[model samples]
Target chain A: MIRFDRVSKRYPPGVDALSDISFEVAEREMVLVSGHSGAGKSTLLKLIAAVEKSTGGAVLVGGQNVSGLARAALPYLRRRIGMVFQDQKLLFDRNAFENVMLPLSITGFPRREAAQRVRAALDKVGLSSREKALPVMLSGGEQQRLAIARAVVGRPKLLLADEPTAHLDADTAADVARIFKEFNHVGVTVLIATYAGDLFPGARRLQLEHGKLLP
Target chain B: MTAWLAQHGDAVRLAMRRLASAPVNSLLYLLAIGVALALPAGGQMLLANALSLAGTTSAVPHISVFMAANADRGMAAEIESRLKKRGDIKRVQFLPREETLARMKANPGLRDVIEALAANPFPDAFVLAVADERPEAMERLAVELRQLPRVEHVQLDSAWVRRLDALLQLGRTAVLVLGVLLSAGLIAISFSIIRMQVLTHRTEIEVSGLLGATDGFIRRPFLYYGLLLGLGGGIVAWLLVGAAALWLRAPLGELVRLYDLTLVLQTPGTRDSALLLAFAAGLGWLGAIISLQQHLRKS
Candidate 1:
């Protein structure tokens, strides 16, 4: 579970990324954060993940106030919430399988279990056969799918996607959306931030205008 | 603990893997590290040799006992007996008046004067050898030996001992200064090199940070990189110092034998080698930590 209670992030130069935001995602909800470029989409995801500090108010995930989490516990907190970047962010030196296995490995999964889970996640993203291929060898859509596999491989309780469908075609975007839907169906909470219209259908949409959440 | 290490192990493993992938570069760094370590190691070998040579050959412990002018030959002989029975005394030789006159009798320049003298004109004396090898012990034994009736004076043969001790002390100081300066230079070199790498890889590190990698996860590989470089450097330094010692070992051994000394150079002992390895790793770790502080805040 993820909750934000009147969370506001103001930069030093008087720019507010997220202003007085209050929202929550339940156990298996698929919530689309629909906003244009600077509607605090990434900031909101960062707050939930404890990647950035909030200026005022609190962001809670799994009953731990991330705003109040100790620095030492931040890593453990991050281990539970998976984040998929718009960019693949794959290590060029590593193959697709290794890339997908990064999260599980970082979170201390056993090798055999990590391999099995990585295989399953890659299969879900339609990258089962290309696990050994490097990011440079994979197409844009394949790389984006690899990113999704990496995020989901650890079986995080919360999945936060920041424009994960950016580089894919309409057909490929729909395919990725189905992968997200399948993950949500399996009881993983999914919150996707997207400016890509008609990408994820039948999802509860929360719009953001400027720094304020649209009612 | 197992889980944390399992998560972070990739950074260390990857760093080493990269080294294996670039064998030539790795060798180059190793060579640099080795050269840095050899200097003080060789200095240590030099000082060890210099000390044994100076201590044994230069200073031979000896004590001198003088008799009172009024002391008769019988009383001086009694004193000699007392000195000989002491456990600290190694050996004693006495010069009685008649023997002293005889020794003067043998001197060609003093023979005329000795024959013309109305008196024996010489008090009896004893020379002592102390069982103690060190200067301080020999001095104490000499003072105690002079306490006999008719023993008017005592001398500890310690002039050469003092000189050698000073020389040895000076040599050690030089070695210490050289070692410290060299170690500091190597650490600085490592720090700058790692800093350069951090600057070059700035964008890559930033990306890793933004993608939810923890600060420590990003720091892990760099730590390995620092450690490997330092260790490789230390090994190189060890080899270089060993080769130089080997090259000079026979010639130096022969030169020492010419001085009638059994001086030997110590190979950098196990303790020294271990310290060098640890030193290398510590220096590298410090450098990487510096780089982390300067960067990695964003990611």
Candidate 2:
């Protein structure tokens, strides 16, 4: 449920992070945005998530213009879309369960239901036993899994992951990729940005070079 | 309404947890707020006592109209009749020179002193009890009596009472200014503490923001933190002022007994305690709102 009408993101000092990129990912479609470092994959996802506005053309998520969305409306837009940053962005002070429960809490889910859903999500990510362990206590793969649980706990329709498996070993990356595939299989629109498009088999690939979409 | 209560309850719980995370720091901040509030409160209490003492110790106000030495008996009679006609004078008692001398002679040691005088030195006087005890009204009556033909001097005996009232008024204003300054200081201290807490929880806050948390959601716990600190400080201040008042009660009672003055310290009552708590909570909430506006904008 995302469409970009020739979206372009330009930074100061004449730097173009993304230029004239247009694409669409239909509902429940699993896609991979393959790009090298600084190829504007993150910018594209950020534009869809409404984290960063498109400078030139319009970006639409859920049929609404992301560029024109009011500040008060950004939260609703973000609530519909789950985001995973490359750095994991897990709270080091809290245990794994709290990190996963954050999004549910933000949405004001009942505590009992929220705990149940958090447990289910953590279970899906194979983090059930480590629920009480802090992020510092988890391995890189487990932290990535924790982030995925947090992002998906709200059951966002669209999942935007930026280099989610960046620092993982091949097997762990495969495991993480499998988790994404599982969510996508359940009718969630998933667009993953990664250099290893080969990791996500049978998914539509949108390759980018210098922010321009390649056929 | 249920949901609103639940939300606030959750926020308060979280705030308590956050405050409990750093017990020592919270206690110190609370103590600072308490001491700041206590200073003005103590000042106000002492001033109240001073005012009450002034009220009791001052003599009953009266106006003394003294007739000139050369004035005749007819002039004295006419003056007394004129004073009795005025509505301002509720009662007028004439004291003849012979009676004034005889009363002085009755005093134990003053008998010899009065006999040494060749003649009665006391002049004919009228002691006028005025209708109003107000200082202004008494002063006005004294002014009117001075203009009487045979009246040599008019004494408004409430002059020292008026001066004490003025001094007490000045003290009340000083206490008010001190209270205002301390309130500002309390707010500033809470603001600083909230700012530090925001810094400490920066990542959690940012993550929550990213997860579509509303600004109100993000600000709720911090506001509660400020409010709790302020409230704790208020309680400490109340206890401190109460204890100090208790400690001073004995000493103050002894001092008043020595002076034969009917005055006692009026400790802060329920209304005062309630006001102190309300003020602390208000300042804490305000500080939290300010800090949240600043730091949340950055996030």
- Using DockQ as the measure, the top candidate is 2
DockQ for the candidate 2 complex? 0.64
Candidate 1 ranges beyond 4 A from true positions: B1-11, B21-25, B51-60, B65-91, B95-125, B131-155, B197-218, B263-266, B289-299
lDDT of 1 by residue, B57-85 (tens): 74566787889878887887788778878
Give every collision pair in model 2: none
What's model 2's lDDT at A95? 93
lDDT of 2 by residue, B1-299 (tens): 55567678888988998888889988898899999999998897788678667767645788898999888889999999999999989999999988998899999799998899887888999888899999888887788789999789999888877787788889989999999999999888988899999999988888887889888888999999999999999999989998999889988888888878755667888888898889898998898888888877886
Return the top candidate by lDDT: 2
Q: What are the per-residue Cα lDDT tens digits for candidate 1 across A133-160?
A: 9899988888888888888887887898
TM-score of chain B of 2: 0.89
Report DockQ per prediction, comma-separated. 0.35, 0.64
- Span of ten consecutive residues with least summed lDDT in model 1 chain B: B203-212
